[model samples]
Target: MIVMDSKAQLTVDIIAKVAEHKMTIVNAAKLLNKSRRTIERYLQQYLKVGIQFVVHRNTGKAPVNKTPDSLKRQVQALIKEKYFDVNLLHLAELLEVNEHILVKRETLRSWAHNIHHVKRAKRRRAKARKRRERMESPGLLLQMDGSPHRWFGDKKSCLIAMIDDATSEVHAEFFPSETTVGCLKVMRDCIESKGLFKALYVDRAGIFGGPKRCNFSQMQRACEELGIEIIFANSPQGKGRVERAFNTFQDRLVPELRLNNIKDMASANAYLKHVFIPQFWQSQIQVKAKDRASEFTPLPTHINLDDICVIKEHRKIRNDHTFSYGNKLYLIDSPLKYSIANQKIEVRNTSKKGFTAYFAARRLQVSEVVETSKFDTEELEIQKKLDVLALAEKLGNISEASRLSGVSRDTIYRHLKLVKEGGADALKRQETPNLRHKNCVDLDVEKTVINFSLEHPHLGQQKVALQLNARYGLDISPNGVRGIWLREKMNTTALRVEKSLSLLKTA
Candidate 1:
């Protein structure tokens, strides 16, 4: 009583008719769209198995080529877990290459269609413009750019790349951020390994001394020194070779790095230099140039890239084989024969050599010169003022004092007026005392403390206080002695000595 499908039912009815002689084998074969031999074979099958034979033995079974449910589930989980936002083609390739899953692109696409949202490849807008041909030979022109991408998982970094226009050979590295040094390193590697290219093609970034840059940038100066031509692109599309290469890298290189577990810049750069570029990229991507011979000039023996690629500025040498750099005084390690004072010397900064001075490319050894603090000189200015006043008092001639002390006439007149208004006490700089506090320390006790502190300036406040108490039977405490010194502005040994000298000079 099993209800067969339409094809099965038709086959059973036709075989029954042929056995009962209701139809000829040719007519039965025509109804079932079978040949005479097939109808006869069906008749023999009918007799042997009856209606049950019409049903296929493998009915209600799955196809052998059907994908496994477990695998489908794993793909679904991987898409949501790790491979989200990746297109189907890239996902499939990543599965095969990274995860060792052998799912086809079409099959992966079908599986992803039922998931939340299918990740599609990023569609780039085609720019319609006049197509320019590649450079004639390798090293004719190299296009360079920085691509900001999350190549190392979630952390974003820039991959500065330089690509040969003719051969499409590339050198790239990852940097924390896009900077002048990062750009310089990329070019430096290109120049060192393959010699100097004829010209460089790049966008008008401020690093390249474009309109945004106020002065000539180091990158521009470096290229000029190496005799490499710099061609600034008006628009990004003008340097389309490297731009498109970056797009491809973001699509393909990101997954490869993720698979290889490359997180930091050092590991990423090593792989890029040793494994990826030479092994996979050069073998797969680079094409033959129109001319096989390279246009790269051989690097000269005399040209040291280390010197050329640095921050250079001119500094004038002082009389004592000293020069100030980065606001710090430094002395030349050895004396010079010729007159080096006031001679212009070039100073270069690099990570290897901290700061180096050069005179016509000859290195000058130097060390940081620790200059004396101005605290030592601050008292000097005050002493000069006192000396000028003392000279005027001794000479009794205002004009002669003005000439001798180098003190301006106006300043001498001001000090002389202050002396006339008050006595010599007013001439010495001292703060006005609190006249309301009549219970001040006794003049005899203050004078003894000042004399004791100046004589034993090497001793601390506590020792001085103890000695004063022991010798003079004074009851003043350590803080009381310190307070007296603070009032006298002789709180330290140097300060006490300076004050004593000034007092002697005035006397």
Candidate 2:
């Protein structure tokens, strides 16, 4: 039997049937189990559709004494003049509270529509075509993304999210910053907690891969060692699931952080781990259990998380009871009195800064630890920039500061404007006073040229200018020697270059 929960719809159906059968309202009500007044109303509506005698009595009735055109214009003008950006609901409340003008929600919606007409509403672009869902098994494809957001209400933080392709369950915590180390830690946690995913999907970041010109980056090399395959998205659209999840998080997660009063990454991580994850899983997730049954293969429990998270290096104990690690020396306290020099040992760098020595998977004591100093100007620059940035963050005037110390206010402001998007590292200076050298096999001719230039004070440049096409059968200028001497003087302690080179007797 055909059934409808709505009585109004049933009445409409009776009216439709009565009109079709060319029956009177009284007869229609007798057949349809409705009151005569209801039948009369139905007959009236039926007749309005050109069925003459059965027209609805209220067909052209005024809409509850209609919202006057003048009042609508007043509301719209008030919006454009004073509250253009006010949302519809708020605007409606404002009209009721301020103007003593009550409005239907639909009427307010109509005002919005008219405003669009006046404002030349932006045309809606065609939505992107929906992609076909390609389902992968659990632990097959892990989507990894760094969501840099205000995880804590007080400050911004980044959470390195690793979600299972099948289950959409996150694997780790909120991070202080979005860095390769943070990602590595998250991935390590995932592997130790959920076992290795078949492949990892990530954006085209340096931490995942490099630009076309560069070879496989350090991150790619690290992934290769872990036996995890990497997949990179060419566009954000390709990673829509995580992008959509981020949108949801921006709305809900921020409010949650506010509620929890999360102020830093550590607290946010605790919330994520202890409270949010469980609640979210229960409320939002729908997992298809193994084999159509409500059962799951519990994650393996034997995997040691620490073993995979650390960087291990093999070293040899030297005769001095010290071992070298990436060239840094660590003194080991072996029970044997003699040095185990040239003997193999293992050095492991866990989460901590200090070196942990292990002899065949067993921990050993280190007597002393020391690191070698290497000439890395780039490393020094990076460290200096880090310190500068940290200080800049402390002092609110970093935005007004410039690379050149004590720069003019105008210049500093101009540079800051230019480098607003660029970070503190952008405001660095390079060393100058470049020099070059060239050699010829003619000693006598060179000495002759040199001696002549040294003796002539004012004519050195002029003679060199003229000797450009006739210098010992070479097209060389005397300014070349002057340039060389000037450059050499900058680096040498010798008071006089002419006196020092005087010892080189002419051949």
For every model in order, what is the number of clashing pairs? 0, 6
Candidate-wise lDDT, in order: 0.85, 0.63
By TM-score, how accurate is candidate 1? 0.61
Worst 10 residues of 1 by lDDT: 430-439
- In candidate 2, which residue ranges exceed 4 Å CA deviation? 1-132, 188-193, 209-227, 285-303, 313-329, 335-346, 352-354, 358-364, 369-507
Give the alpha carbon lDDT tens digit for every residue of 96-129 in model 1: 8768999977788888888865855568987789
Could you tell me the lDDT of residue 418 within candidate 1? 73
For model 2, how does the per-residue alpha-carbon lDDT over 1-507 read when each residue is reduced to its tens digit?
223456546566667777687677787778778798977765775677533333345666877878889998988888777556455655676678667888898888888787783323246775676684634467766778888886666667887777765666767567777776778788877765656666778888877775741646545655676667888887776776666667556545665666556787677778777776787644575365243321123434664545545555678777777876655566777576555678787665655776678876667888647456785887686565555544454665654443434445564454455347665555555464342123532455445554555544335444654764464555455555555446435212242444445645652
Q: What's the C-alpha lDDT at position 230 in model 1?
A: 89
Error of 2 at 446 (Å): 60
Off by over 4 Å in 1: 1-61, 121-127, 153-155, 317-321, 340-343, 374-507
